[model samples]
Target: MKSLSLIVLLSMVFSCNTSAQKKDDQLQNKTAFKVTKTDAEWKAQLTDDQYQVLRKAATERPFSSPLNNNHSKGTYVCAACKTPLYKSEHKFDSGTGWPSFDRVIEGNVAFSTDTTIGYMRNEEHCATCGGHLGHVFDDGPRATTGKRHCINGDALEFVPAKS
Candidate 1:
Protein backbone atom coordinates (compact mmCIF):
# COMPACT_ATOMS: atom_id res chain seq x y z
CA MET A 1 0.00 0.00 0.00
CA LYS A 2 1.14 3.59 -0.62
CA SER A 3 0.58 4.44 3.04
CA LEU A 4 2.84 1.61 4.19
CA SER A 5 5.53 2.60 1.69
CA LEU A 6 5.43 6.24 2.79
CA ILE A 7 5.69 5.30 6.43
CA VAL A 8 8.72 3.08 5.81
CA LEU A 9 10.46 5.81 3.79
CA LEU A 10 9.86 8.41 6.48
CA SER A 11 11.24 6.12 9.16
CA MET A 12 14.40 5.48 7.15
CA VAL A 13 14.96 9.23 6.63
CA PHE A 14 14.60 10.00 10.31
CA SER A 15 16.87 7.13 11.25
CA CYS A 16 19.60 8.38 8.93
CA ASN A 17 19.32 11.90 10.36
CA THR A 18 19.67 10.59 13.89
CA SER A 19 22.71 8.57 12.96
CA ALA A 20 24.31 11.59 11.31
CA GLN A 21 23.73 13.71 14.38
CA LYS A 22 25.40 11.07 16.54
CA LYS A 23 28.38 11.00 14.21
CA ASP A 24 28.74 14.77 14.40
CA ASP A 25 28.63 14.65 18.18
CA GLN A 26 31.34 12.02 18.22
CA LEU A 27 33.53 14.12 15.97
CA GLN A 28 33.10 17.19 18.19
CA ASN A 29 33.97 15.18 21.28
CA LYS A 30 37.21 14.18 19.67
CA THR A 31 38.15 17.72 18.67
CA ALA A 32 41.69 18.54 19.80
CA PHE A 33 41.49 21.01 22.66
CA LYS A 34 44.47 22.76 24.13
CA VAL A 35 42.93 22.69 27.59
CA THR A 36 41.34 19.30 27.91
CA LYS A 37 40.22 17.91 31.24
CA THR A 38 37.85 15.46 32.80
CA ASP A 39 34.57 16.60 34.27
CA ALA A 40 35.92 16.22 37.78
CA GLU A 41 39.02 18.22 36.92
CA TRP A 42 36.99 21.00 35.37
CA LYS A 43 34.72 21.15 38.39
CA ALA A 44 37.76 21.51 40.57
CA GLN A 45 39.28 24.24 38.43
CA LEU A 46 36.18 26.42 38.09
CA THR A 47 33.79 27.90 40.60
CA ASP A 48 30.35 26.37 41.03
CA ASP A 49 28.79 28.98 38.80
CA GLN A 50 31.56 28.75 36.24
CA TYR A 51 31.35 24.99 36.16
CA GLN A 52 27.63 25.16 35.59
CA VAL A 53 27.91 27.67 32.79
CA LEU A 54 31.12 26.52 31.08
CA ARG A 55 30.79 22.79 31.49
CA LYS A 56 27.02 22.43 31.39
CA ALA A 57 26.19 25.36 29.09
CA ALA A 58 24.07 27.02 31.74
CA THR A 59 23.20 30.73 31.62
CA GLU A 60 23.70 33.08 34.51
CA ARG A 61 21.10 35.48 35.88
CA PRO A 62 21.00 38.74 34.00
CA PHE A 63 22.29 41.95 35.64
CA SER A 64 23.99 39.84 38.30
CA SER A 65 27.63 40.17 37.21
CA PRO A 66 29.63 43.30 38.02
CA LEU A 67 31.49 42.70 34.76
CA ASN A 68 28.47 43.95 32.84
CA ASN A 69 28.96 47.47 34.20
CA ASN A 70 32.73 47.47 34.07
CA HIS A 71 34.26 49.88 31.55
CA SER A 72 37.95 49.66 32.31
CA LYS A 73 40.52 48.96 29.62
CA GLY A 74 41.20 45.25 29.78
CA THR A 75 40.79 41.89 28.21
CA TYR A 76 38.10 39.37 28.99
CA VAL A 77 39.33 35.83 28.99
CA CYS A 78 37.63 32.53 29.40
CA ALA A 79 37.24 31.76 33.07
CA ALA A 80 37.80 28.07 32.41
CA CYS A 81 40.70 28.15 29.93
CA LYS A 82 42.11 31.65 30.33
CA THR A 83 41.97 32.26 26.58
CA PRO A 84 41.65 35.91 25.62
CA LEU A 85 38.29 36.27 23.94
CA TYR A 86 36.99 39.83 24.00
CA LYS A 87 38.66 43.17 24.44
CA SER A 88 37.06 45.94 26.47
CA GLU A 89 36.79 48.17 23.42
CA HIS A 90 34.57 45.54 21.81
CA LYS A 91 32.24 45.48 24.82
CA PHE A 92 29.03 47.47 24.83
CA ASP A 93 26.09 47.62 27.19
CA SER A 94 23.29 46.15 25.11
CA GLY A 95 20.94 46.81 28.06
CA THR A 96 20.33 43.08 27.94
CA GLY A 97 21.89 42.81 31.43
CA TRP A 98 24.68 40.68 29.96
CA PRO A 99 28.01 41.90 28.63
CA SER A 100 27.66 42.28 24.87
CA PHE A 101 30.59 42.55 22.52
CA ASP A 102 30.56 43.62 18.91
CA ARG A 103 33.36 41.21 18.11
CA VAL A 104 35.89 38.82 19.59
CA ILE A 105 39.56 38.03 19.32
CA GLU A 106 39.72 36.20 16.02
CA GLY A 107 40.54 32.49 16.13
CA ASN A 108 39.99 32.45 19.91
CA VAL A 109 36.26 31.77 19.76
CA ALA A 110 34.32 29.04 17.99
CA PHE A 111 30.63 28.83 17.27
CA SER A 112 28.14 26.01 16.91
CA THR A 113 24.41 25.83 16.58
CA ASP A 114 22.72 25.54 19.95
CA THR A 115 19.16 24.30 20.26
CA THR A 116 19.09 23.95 24.04
CA ILE A 117 16.89 27.05 24.36
CA GLY A 118 14.22 25.47 22.08
CA TYR A 119 15.55 27.52 19.18
CA MET A 120 18.71 27.49 17.12
CA ARG A 121 21.21 30.19 18.04
CA ASN A 122 24.94 30.50 17.43
CA GLU A 123 26.56 29.50 20.70
CA GLU A 124 30.07 30.79 21.28
CA HIS A 125 32.72 28.68 22.97
CA CYS A 126 36.35 28.90 23.90
CA ALA A 127 38.37 27.58 20.97
CA THR A 128 40.97 26.16 23.30
CA CYS A 129 38.62 24.18 25.50
CA GLY A 130 35.18 24.23 23.91
CA GLY A 131 33.82 25.73 27.08
CA HIS A 132 30.52 27.50 26.58
CA LEU A 133 30.86 31.29 26.68
CA GLY A 134 27.49 32.46 25.40
CA HIS A 135 25.45 33.11 22.26
CA VAL A 136 26.13 35.45 19.33
CA PHE A 137 23.25 37.19 17.66
CA ASP A 138 22.82 39.31 14.56
CA ASP A 139 21.59 42.36 16.43
CA GLY A 140 24.62 44.53 17.14
CA PRO A 141 26.29 47.79 16.17
CA ARG A 142 26.10 48.12 12.41
CA ALA A 143 29.44 49.91 12.30
CA THR A 144 31.22 46.70 13.13
CA THR A 145 30.36 43.06 12.56
CA GLY A 146 26.68 43.65 13.21
CA LYS A 147 26.91 40.76 15.59
CA ARG A 148 26.39 40.76 19.32
CA HIS A 149 28.46 38.37 21.33
CA CYS A 150 26.06 38.18 24.26
CA ILE A 151 28.24 36.55 26.84
CA ASN A 152 27.71 35.30 30.39
CA GLY A 153 29.89 37.23 32.80
CA ASP A 154 30.46 34.16 34.92
CA ALA A 155 32.17 32.59 31.94
CA LEU A 156 34.67 35.44 31.69
CA GLU A 157 37.48 36.87 33.86
CA PHE A 158 38.60 40.42 33.20
CA VAL A 159 42.28 41.34 33.24
CA PRO A 160 42.77 45.10 33.57
CA ALA A 161 45.54 46.93 31.80
CA LYS A 162 48.44 48.32 33.84
CA SER A 163 48.37 52.09 34.26
Candidate 2:
Protein backbone atom coordinates (compact mmCIF):
# COMPACT_ATOMS: atom_id res chain seq x y z
CA MET A 1 0.00 0.00 0.00
CA LYS A 2 2.86 2.40 0.81
CA SER A 3 4.51 1.70 -2.55
CA LEU A 4 1.24 2.43 -4.32
CA SER A 5 0.84 5.70 -2.41
CA LEU A 6 4.35 6.74 -3.32
CA ILE A 7 3.64 6.14 -7.01
CA VAL A 8 0.48 8.20 -6.82
CA LEU A 9 2.36 11.06 -5.12
CA LEU A 10 5.08 10.97 -7.77
CA SER A 11 2.48 11.06 -10.54
CA MET A 12 0.82 14.07 -8.98
CA VAL A 13 4.13 15.90 -8.74
CA PHE A 14 4.94 15.11 -12.37
CA SER A 15 1.57 16.36 -13.53
CA CYS A 16 1.96 19.60 -11.62
CA ASN A 17 5.43 20.12 -12.96
CA THR A 18 4.23 19.64 -16.51
CA SER A 19 1.43 22.15 -16.03
CA ALA A 20 3.80 24.72 -14.60
CA GLN A 21 6.16 24.27 -17.49
CA LYS A 22 3.34 24.87 -19.94
CA LYS A 23 2.42 28.12 -18.26
CA ASP A 24 6.03 29.21 -18.27
CA ASP A 25 6.29 28.41 -21.94
CA GLN A 26 3.25 30.54 -22.71
CA LEU A 27 4.72 33.48 -20.87
CA GLN A 28 8.07 33.08 -22.57
CA ASN A 29 6.39 33.06 -26.00
CA LYS A 30 5.07 36.53 -25.41
CA THR A 31 7.13 39.17 -27.20
CA ALA A 32 4.99 42.20 -26.51
CA PHE A 33 6.20 44.61 -23.86
CA LYS A 34 5.32 48.14 -22.86
CA VAL A 35 7.27 50.72 -24.83
CA THR A 36 6.97 54.30 -23.63
CA LYS A 37 9.57 56.59 -22.14
CA THR A 38 10.23 60.29 -21.61
CA ASP A 39 13.47 61.79 -22.89
CA ALA A 40 15.06 62.17 -19.49
CA GLU A 41 13.75 58.79 -18.41
CA TRP A 42 15.33 57.16 -21.43
CA LYS A 43 18.59 58.98 -20.94
CA ALA A 44 18.75 57.73 -17.38
CA GLN A 45 17.76 54.17 -18.25
CA LEU A 46 20.43 53.69 -20.90
CA THR A 47 24.21 53.67 -20.73
CA ASP A 48 26.45 56.06 -22.65
CA ASP A 49 27.00 53.68 -25.53
CA GLN A 50 23.33 52.72 -25.61
CA TYR A 51 22.31 56.37 -25.45
CA GLN A 52 24.71 57.42 -28.18
CA VAL A 53 23.54 54.68 -30.49
CA LEU A 54 19.90 54.72 -29.46
CA ARG A 55 19.40 58.43 -28.85
CA LYS A 56 22.12 60.69 -30.26
CA ALA A 57 22.53 58.72 -33.50
CA ALA A 58 25.90 57.07 -33.29
CA THR A 59 27.46 54.00 -34.92
CA GLU A 60 29.95 51.50 -33.57
CA ARG A 61 33.09 50.36 -35.34
CA PRO A 62 32.86 47.75 -38.07
CA PHE A 63 32.80 44.18 -36.75
CA SER A 64 32.97 45.75 -33.31
CA SER A 65 29.44 44.95 -32.18
CA PRO A 66 29.04 41.72 -30.27
CA LEU A 67 25.78 41.06 -32.08
CA ASN A 68 27.71 40.99 -35.35
CA ASN A 69 28.60 37.39 -34.55
CA ASN A 70 25.38 36.54 -32.77
CA HIS A 71 23.67 33.80 -34.70
CA SER A 72 20.91 32.97 -32.30
CA LYS A 73 17.20 32.64 -32.82
CA GLY A 74 15.80 35.77 -31.23
CA THR A 75 14.30 39.19 -31.68
CA TYR A 76 16.35 42.38 -31.49
CA VAL A 77 14.75 45.21 -29.57
CA CYS A 78 15.47 48.89 -29.24
CA ALA A 79 17.54 49.58 -26.15
CA ALA A 80 15.47 52.69 -25.51
CA CYS A 81 11.88 51.54 -25.99
CA LYS A 82 12.22 47.76 -25.82
CA THR A 83 10.28 47.68 -29.04
CA PRO A 84 10.89 44.66 -31.22
CA LEU A 85 12.94 45.89 -34.14
CA TYR A 86 14.39 42.88 -35.93
CA LYS A 87 14.24 39.11 -36.00
CA SER A 88 17.31 36.97 -35.62
CA GLU A 89 16.36 35.16 -38.81
CA HIS A 90 16.71 38.47 -40.62
CA LYS A 91 20.18 39.11 -39.24
CA PHE A 92 23.08 38.23 -41.49
CA ASP A 93 26.78 38.68 -42.11
CA SER A 94 27.24 41.86 -44.16
CA GLY A 95 31.00 42.32 -43.69
CA THR A 96 30.19 45.95 -42.82
CA GLY A 97 31.50 45.79 -39.22
CA TRP A 98 28.02 46.10 -37.71
CA PRO A 99 25.11 43.84 -37.02
CA SER A 100 23.12 43.72 -40.25
CA PHE A 101 19.53 42.62 -40.63
CA ASP A 102 17.76 41.97 -43.85
CA ARG A 103 14.58 43.44 -42.44
CA VAL A 104 13.09 44.91 -39.29
CA ILE A 105 10.16 43.98 -37.12
CA GLU A 106 7.03 45.47 -38.65
CA GLY A 107 6.07 49.03 -37.67
CA ASN A 108 8.89 49.27 -35.17
CA VAL A 109 11.69 51.09 -36.98
CA ALA A 110 11.57 53.92 -39.45
CA PHE A 111 13.90 55.44 -42.02
CA SER A 112 14.95 59.06 -42.27
CA THR A 113 17.25 61.31 -44.25
CA ASP A 114 20.64 61.29 -42.53
CA THR A 115 23.09 63.98 -43.56
CA THR A 116 25.08 63.92 -40.36
CA ILE A 117 28.04 62.25 -42.06
CA GLY A 118 27.94 64.82 -44.89
CA TYR A 119 26.29 62.35 -47.20
CA MET A 120 22.75 61.25 -47.93
CA ARG A 121 22.09 58.02 -46.11
CA ASN A 122 19.04 56.19 -44.87
CA GLU A 123 19.02 56.59 -41.13
CA GLU A 124 17.14 54.08 -38.99
CA HIS A 125 15.38 54.80 -35.71
CA CYS A 126 12.87 53.34 -33.35
CA ALA A 127 9.54 54.16 -34.91
CA THR A 128 7.67 54.24 -31.63
CA CYS A 129 10.15 56.43 -29.70
CA GLY A 130 12.21 58.24 -32.34
CA GLY A 131 15.42 56.75 -30.99
CA HIS A 132 18.28 56.39 -33.40
CA LEU A 133 19.36 52.88 -34.39
CA GLY A 134 21.71 53.20 -37.35
CA HIS A 135 21.54 53.21 -41.16
CA VAL A 136 20.40 51.00 -44.03
CA PHE A 137 21.84 50.45 -47.46
CA ASP A 138 21.00 48.73 -50.72
CA ASP A 139 24.09 46.59 -50.65
CA GLY A 140 23.04 43.09 -49.65
CA PRO A 141 22.90 39.63 -51.13
CA ARG A 142 20.00 38.77 -53.39
CA ALA A 143 18.96 35.82 -51.26
CA THR A 144 17.11 38.18 -48.94
CA THR A 145 15.93 41.76 -49.18
CA GLY A 146 18.49 43.79 -51.08
CA LYS A 147 18.51 46.11 -48.06
CA ARG A 148 20.75 45.87 -45.05
CA HIS A 149 19.72 47.50 -41.81
CA CYS A 150 23.15 48.52 -40.51
CA ILE A 151 22.47 48.72 -36.81
CA ASN A 152 24.67 49.88 -33.95
CA GLY A 153 24.99 46.86 -31.69
CA ASP A 154 24.89 49.07 -28.63
CA ALA A 155 21.44 50.30 -29.66
CA LEU A 156 19.91 46.85 -29.46
CA GLU A 157 19.28 44.05 -26.99
CA PHE A 158 18.46 40.63 -28.36
CA VAL A 159 15.71 38.48 -26.85
CA PRO A 160 15.58 34.93 -28.10
CA ALA A 161 12.17 33.97 -29.41
CA LYS A 162 10.61 30.74 -28.20
CA SER A 163 10.73 27.96 -30.72
Against the hidden reference, what TM-scores do the models get?
Answer: 0.88, 0.74
What is the per-residue lDDT of model 1 for residues 1-163, given as tens digits with 9 covering 90 to 100? 9999999999998777565465346325736678789999998899999999898889999999999999999999999888999999999989999999999999999777778769988888898988889999999999888999999999999999888
State how far residue 157 of model 2 sits from its true place (Å). 0.4
What TM-score should be assigned to candidate 1?
0.88
Candidate number with greatest TM-score: 1
For model 1, state the Cα shift of residue 22 in Å: 7.0
Which candidate ranks first by lDDT, i.e. highest? 1
TM-score of 2: 0.74
Model 2 stretches astray by more than 4 angstroms: 1-39
Predicted structure 1: lDDT: 0.89
Q: Clashes in each model (backbone N, CA, C under 3 Å)?
A: 0, 2
